[model samples]
Target: MNLQSILSQHIIKAVSESYAATLENIEFQATRKDFEGDITVVVFSMLRTVKGNPVQIGETIGEYLVANVAEVSKYNVVKGFLNLVLSDAYYLDFFTSIQNFNSYGKVPATTEAIMVEYASPNTNKPLHLGHVRNVLLGYSVAEILKAAGKKVYKTQIINDRGIHICKSMLAWKRYGNEETPQTSGLKGDKLVGNYYVKFDKEYKKEINTLVENGFTEKDAKAKAPILLEAQKMLQKWEAGDPDVVALWKKMNGWVYEGFDATYENIGVDFDKNYYESDTYLLGKDFIQSGLEKGVFEKDADGSVWCDLTDEGLDRKIVLRSDGTAVYMTQDIGTAIQRVKDFPDINGMIYTVGNEQDYHFKVLFLILKKLGFSWAENLYHLSYGMVDLPSGKMKSREGTVVDADDLISDMAATAKEISEELGKIDDFSAEEKTQLYKTIGLGALKYYILKVDPKKRILFNPEESVDFQGNTGPFIQYTYARIQSILRKAASASGYTESVEIRNLTLEPKEKELLKILQQFPDVIQLAAGNYSPALVANYTYDLVKEFNSFYQNVPIFGAENPAEISFRISLCDAVGSVINTAFSLLGIQVPDKM
Candidate 1:
């Protein structure tokens, strides 16, 4: 079922005897180009201080494979690379295997439970483009891991408490006297975001008046009553001040309402969510536990700190002198809580930004030092920032793109393009709506996941990703086309023609597409193995590209032999299934027509 395992078995059979009966992990990797064949088995790692050259070693392996491996019909030895040519029968079996199982493309199930925390945003503002990147990457990674058979629990800890949130609330109280989202015709989060921006303007003006009398920025910030009141507001809400709690709930609900639409549009959701307001006290208890075990020490200022100086890290304050929990403290407690809640969990993956790489390193290490063995499985799935083509987006300057607005604009643009390209001419209402949604989301997800996660992407709105070529909609459309061909073939065959692919004519197009399909399971495994959904992104694009090439060159069901017609039709169906499965992983859907 796992393609890589089977291929490695074939490779080991070919090369193990030459390695003196001691070789393991034959290391057969998929090739990028078709000329090199599907799977290339490397022989260098097996040879150490060898008397024979790598070229000679490769030569022996290739010959052995061609002679001994029945599935490998041909072989080439090129610079320590053994490129294998799989027999048509192998592809025939693979096509039949996948086609027989309607759920063959579904992610296999596993007993290992995982908690993936991502999209941890404050309730003060509308979601931004950066959040989009985080959400999609998180969603895709969850989908990939699930595909590899993991019981995944998606979660997020909302930064719903603190001065940042109060800034928005304060501005609303001062300037928005009884105005609501319904009255203003603005989204709840965007309406709240307007006040967040307003707060910065007022804060800057008030701070300037203070600085004119020689007050430093820090002193001016301290002197600001609004800042003090915001902190008081947090305390009041915590101590069961009904009025303060009511206001907090009202504002936070507005943000959540807007966020739900964004999450639905992007196709990302969580299994559970934690609020900072609810879990802050839990952090203090964990700090006390750490102190009791000598994992932390109270400073002269009465602040609890974790001494990480030996690790070239700063001594981090887990709790302030006033006994309030810091961000790191809350994370520690939440980690403990989740593991306790789901003791059978195999791992916890925090899909966070690379800026917090050091933070996660310390957190994981501290958890281990505190005697949590499962800390070893806790991973930080960090990704680079998504900056604009001009530079990074600045929120205080009000240049940040709103997530809802951006998607709406993209969908509108997509609809316009659809009309221009005549793709919308023959569609019913539902069909047109589906096409629009598919194109919109496909473009967005593909653009975000196309690059490697660690590399920051420079996104330019003007030079946006195209739907006509090398884009998600291109793949989506191609998939629809494949389905169309299959439908036509099925009707012509009277829906009962099942052909034996054992003698499928090995045309160049058919062979290439077959090989690509055979590698889908490995693509899923590798994507899940490296915790990178970009692998699936790349694989899906490559598969679509191969399918297009095959379509342009090979005419299916036009051949003389019924065997050839049925074989080609089934293979096409297999290709469509692969594309559908792949699209689902990236949270993109295939439109039946486009």
Candidate 2:
């Protein structure tokens, strides 16, 4: 139903051949302004097996293709490439096609279920800039998949227990810290994080003093019993010791409350939340089950491990030698539990840092060993970390970018920009804040998503995100401008489609512009196929740049011919829809005014 399918079908049918799905790629090329085409098809790629001169083969195929195709007005074989030019008369039909289906270029009957797990954060602290990357990549992946007719399941896992959480609890308890979040005038996560840092400082000093004596640093650190006491606290809560459970529940509630605000602000959500605390025991059971099934082996001292050395991976510990759960154990248990919860699930995906590539590789291998047929469906959407200009962010050195503080800072900057532009003169105070939230969050999400997810990116606050040129705000403003023009055009009196565009006879600028505009569908399919939202990001900017050029060179409303005006308006509508949809897939909201 989309442009590619229609065009591909025409090509295959003319060849007297059939495929389950046709393979066709449409792209823009630069071959000097004198070149007579917009989109170039590499006919050589298809004809290489035939063993002939690519130029003649392209010419023959291009002629045959034009004979079968009605949408394309003409074809030119240039330097062994067959470039097809779409007829201006068929432009309205294509626009009408997209408008009618409401799917735009999304292929029908190509339903795939995708699980996107993003924005997974630890409860010990609020989210940081690192989490923003995870959230953006995960959200964008889900949106891209959904746009391609896939049912996407978004989920998150909270690393809410273990030594990390214990550090905060210990600090809060020992520092005369009966102070609650509200009482201390601090956000929930920040209040808890203060104690986490404090514990590290205090614990390190205690270990240093012990080391200054006869004890080794390692021995002294282990002998201090702080982490042991933290473990005891965890055990007490698990045992339903009333006071310990009360504190644990209260503190975690505040953290969740803070996390909810952050998620809501950033337009990120998950269908399910998996807590390490709840699932660690499930992992233990899963490991024991794997052991009984002859998929795993027992270590000395009653520990459990999975040996993947045969697969060029090191052995992984599941449960500690003391039989307590490790992070890996909890992950294994959660995967199984998720499958059990949703037996109809076609797949599971983990959105985690690239640093954990080895961890997930081992996890999936163990799952496959346990005979889970869906192991092949498991995916690790590993994204690189966001580092600062100085280098990698480290918490102990206090270089970590706290999530709430950073968002607040960005929102304030957005507010300043909005005020400078007088963009919210008509809005209420609360509405103004909402606008700031939208702008700030959209800026952050788009900034993160525009880069290839696999590559490490420096989130330079100054240069990386600018108000003008290829930023989220630029696209939003373009959408708003088109909307304004359309509103004015619609309200204008006595307008009619009075002229015909039999020969496109376009200016060089218009041809260059149309070339990019026509590739929207192809871009969507590529983004979906690759599981990469950067494709969408790149496509949106390309379209915007084309539209900008078109806007400057061509007059829509004041054109001499009414038909030309109407045609231009229709073109604007199509371009606007594609821009909006593409940005939506990148988890960016377009504002009507900004």
Find the candidate with the highest lDDT and give its number: 1
Looking at candidate 2, what is the lDDT of residue 530? 76
lDDT of 1 by residue, 1-594 (tens): 465676666556655566554456667677547455767877677675334677777777778767766777787777777777777788777766664434554566868888888779989998888999888888888888888889999898898987788788888888998678789887888888899899889888888888898999999988876667767876776688898777778988988998898898877889999888777667678788899998899999999999989888888888999887787888888889988878888679998889999999999978887888788898898999988877888887887877877787778778888888895687887777667877888898898887788888888888766777778888988888988887697568433455566776588778788777767777888988888878888888888898898888877767667787777777777778888888888888887677
Every candidate's CA RMSD: 2.9, 4.1
Candidates in order, TM-scores: namely 0.92, 0.88
Local accuracy by lDDT, each model: 0.80, 0.75
* Residue ranges of candidate 2 with Cα displaced over 4 Å: 1-34, 41-75, 101-103, 106-112, 299-301, 422-431, 462-464, 495-518
| TM-score for candidate 2 | 0.88
lDDT of 1: 0.80
Q: Name the weakest run of 10 consecutive residues (lDDT summed) in model 2.
A: 18-27
Query: Which residue pairs collide, candidate 1?
Result: none
